[model samples]
Target: MNSQAIADRCEQADVELIRLLYVGNDGVVRGHAVEQDHVPDALESGVPLPELVQSFNALGHRVKDAQFDAVGEVRLLPDCSSFRVLDHEDRVAAVLCSLRDSESGHPWSADPRSALSRQLADLADEGLEAALALESEFHLVTDGEEPSPHGDQGVYSTASMRNGHDVILDVVDALQAQGINVHKYYPEYAAGKHEIVTKYGRGIGAVDDYVFLRETVAAVAESHGLGTTFLPYPFDGATNGCHVHLSLWDGDNRFAPSDGDRALSPMGRHFVGGILAHVPALLALTSPTVNSYARLRPQAGAAAYGCWGVENREAAVRIPTAAPGERDTATRVEYRPADNTANPYLSVLGLLAAGLDGIRNEIDPGPPLEADPANCDEATLTDRDIDRLPTTLGEALDALADDDVLRSALGEELTESYLTVKRSEWDAFTDSAATWERERLRDTF
Candidate 1:
């Protein structure tokens, strides 16, 4: 919809506020709300935001980066296509914004959303497109000094559904009201954990949908007098992971194998190969935070090694089994090392860039590991050429610094700012006297 159309809809709906939303470098959604009277002008001219927002850490501390000082401004240019009337709130509407230079009106080099758009444009230039769906896991907890799961039911059990039935139904309703389609919803492994799968979206719209999904889920849970968290390791028994399912297409499913016996097409193999080749560096964006590392351990179902397999949970990438007759559309790769803590736009951008590089160079992903990497002995691991992913955020950042391919894809300004902000987070976590896990980490995400 255009600005005028959005204004008309708001007028009809009696929307009192319109939020101009954008995800920050810290992977948190931050935005300014405009009164209904200012909707048209804000949509047209964009909302001005401080340039230093790109340099703030997740804890809201501004990193000491020289390039991202508090001297300039960037405009939050709302994408009219992303306009949605939030059903969970009272007379409030929202639209996702892309950061643009305040004076020049060009996309800001440090804008994560714009970065994803650039990657998509490059893929379009090569006659390829990507569809992505995110499987988001989060926890619902009761309020107190130490919050516990809201329900006591087990994983995937009917009792679990019965326990959280009202809240879950409300969440689905709110999402559908905002035009987000829900594919599935189920109780996850832990007591209070839940997973929601949404229908796939092409290009950057997938990430935009994910942002809305997180916000909607959180808001609905809050209305029910419960707390929600997407943190990877909120209370330890189970981890919250937002696995990314991606497929490449050129008017057809390129990931589908032509031969009946083969698992993936040549292009699909190359894509997975590229992802494996860059797993360590990719984790800098995928598993981004210090808290995220707590979830990426062996035997934890979070994928601890850089390998691909058919339905292997221990490998970072997995080729899921397609439905009996829906192979063409169902063929895709699931990257499992990610969580809700990472910025979705940057994570998918890095994934696509790495996969495209693999296609360009015909990077072979070698043989798929049929067995779990964690169970394999050292010699077997070496023979199969499997490598462990970075065990900590600092190590992942170092890998990202050394990776020329990813750095070039993210560009200099974004790379520098991202690194500076992440490194500062690492240092803060390591040096702080507080219980980093419970005190600082639990409530942030």
Candidate 2:
């Protein structure tokens, strides 16, 4: 593009940031990103401004291949998620980009986006592919609570979306304005709760859409005097979650487990079996929060046990069980454990690792517990020998620690770092007297 055209685009980005300064979430402010859950912290303490520039230049050199172009305009390209450092209007500063492999199709370890990309490449190695999708769930909170309650809406329905329809519409517009495609959206079970189902996505792009969606939704919601949260079980008994749906394939063939059926054939069942076998461990990535336990209970609609079957939501892994080819065309398994809480990078990596382990070992996933495993007697579970998933984040972490196959997926450094962070979080929780414990034990003691 010519010099004048480039000048105009940079001016447009400055104009957008200025407007956002006026309407963007107050937390985002004019020069800082809202420090929310797990937002990356920069700790270059006490360094001089000149030294910081050298350090920043070194940071850019880490991933020298996926070059960014934000000097003259808002760099919103396929490989880069727009980075607008309000502090540096003329040049690039802070960013969250889609990392691509410089050498092969595999993802780079330094770039979190590549974690899922590598997994997808691994799937292709087995002559199979994964079609990945995600669900978005969060609450809408106002500055006040009771006297001025939020919107009235039912689960999987609409009313709240209509009452707060303007913000919802703006959210869609903003995302589309940036070329992201969100499918259907509606009210969730709780008041002011909502969910978004995006158009089919695959690999790093799938996760790219996810992070961008959450970041964008919050941005738009702020403009409407509403706050959006992807927190699972933001309230006790809310049971809200972000479940990932997946299906396998061998080139054009969709994979599922059906006897005598070459399609979704035995290989497919074994893959599902592998998913089931490592499921107890998979929960560490899927449901990675202390509050995650609240949603795993049978009443919460998240299948509490590790099992898979045709058309059973109660199963941790469930197949669509639709018509012939329907299972292929729309064939998929619903992994109902994840929430927005887990880092998208690690969660997808853990999932691909476990599934690949299943494929490699040729593991046989015992018979399906077509019935509600929860209702089954202890003898029934043991007779079937169905082991329940870890009941707490601590337990899940321990499970991941033991599963070497899982750890190898994220490499040692990333794995160790993740555990260190989570272990610290667990310690902090144990040290505090939570609301539940305070209410239950305070008066009694």
Candidate 3:
């Protein structure tokens, strides 16, 4: 859709307000509201917002090294293709934006969206296309202070899903109304948690859908007299993860795989190998937050090591099962290191960059683990074989700093800003007092 078409739709829908949305480096959705009369001007000239918004830490503190304060402003150029009418918010519509420099009218290098788009363009240059999807898991709570609302049925139970049936259905309807195709919705293992699967999209569309879906879920939950959190650990019930699945295609050919056999093509194997090699640094973007580490432990159901597997959830990269006939289109990789807290643009970009690097260099991924490392006997697996992921945010950032390839892909400005801001977050978290520290150390130690 063009600008004129979007304007026409807004007029037809009687939209009074238009939101130009952008995602922060820490995965927060920040935007500015424009009046109906100013929609055309805003779209053409772009909405002026501080680039600092993108650099702000999760606690709202600005990064000292980001240079956002020096520049002061960046134009949020709306993507006409991503225009969507909000059903929950009255007379309000939204469009995702790419941050651009006011002087040059070029995409800001600091922008996560721009970083991902650049990586995607590289794929296009190589005659390859990527299809991506994110499966989001979240917890619904009646009140934050109180325990979550419980259900009798277990995970994947239809009855448990029906417990919040009206709200869940309403949320799905709202998403569909805004053009997000939700494929599945079901109860998760945790008492108050649920998962929603959306249809795959290409490049920026996938990132846009991810942000829009998260906003919709939170908004609809609020309207239904409940609160929703995508936090990796809300109250120790279960972690919320946003697992990503992706496949590479070359026109008519599925580069990842097409045959019924579980074996990946040479290119596919290298791609997986590339991710396994750079995963420690990749974690700085995939599972970024301080609390994110709480969910990425050895037995937390999240991947704790850098390895590939077939139908093994414990592995960082898993080749999912698909029927022989459907394998041509369905064969893809599931990346499990990420959580809902990650900024999708950065996470996906890093993943692709790593995989493409692997393909270019023909990196070998040793072999797939047949048994779950956490459950298997230690005799079969060596520490060198099951290379564990970084256990802390600080360690992950150190790895990211040393990785020249991944750093160059993200650009120096973003790479520095991300490291600076995240390091501040780590310092604050470590210095702050905690209940466990006081309860154990103050009395016993």
lDDT of 3: 0.85
Top candidate by lDDT? 1
Q: Give the candidates in order of lDDT, highest first.
A: 1, 3, 2
lDDT per residue (tens digit) for residues 1-445 in model 3: 8777778888999999999998878678888989988888888889888767766888888877665675678899998889999978889999999999988999898898888999999889989899999988888878656657545437887777778787789899999998889898889887778888999887789889989999998899888888888988776657889899988988543544644454577788899989988999999999999998988888778888788899888889988876756666777889998988788899999999899889889998877887777776666567436677898998999999999889989999889878877887887787774755787797676
Q: Which ten residues in a row have the lowest lDDT in candidate 2?
A: 18-27
- Model 1 / residue 38 / CA error / Å: 0.8
Question: What local lDDT does model 3 show for residue 415?
Answer: 90
Off by over 4 Å in 1: 433-445
Candidate 1: tens digits of C-alpha lDDT, residues 80-186: 99999996899999999999999999999999999999999999998988999988999999989988888865879989898989999999999999888999999
lDDT (Cα atoms) of all candidates against the true structure: 0.92, 0.59, 0.85
Estimate TM-scores for all models: 0.96, 0.75, 0.95
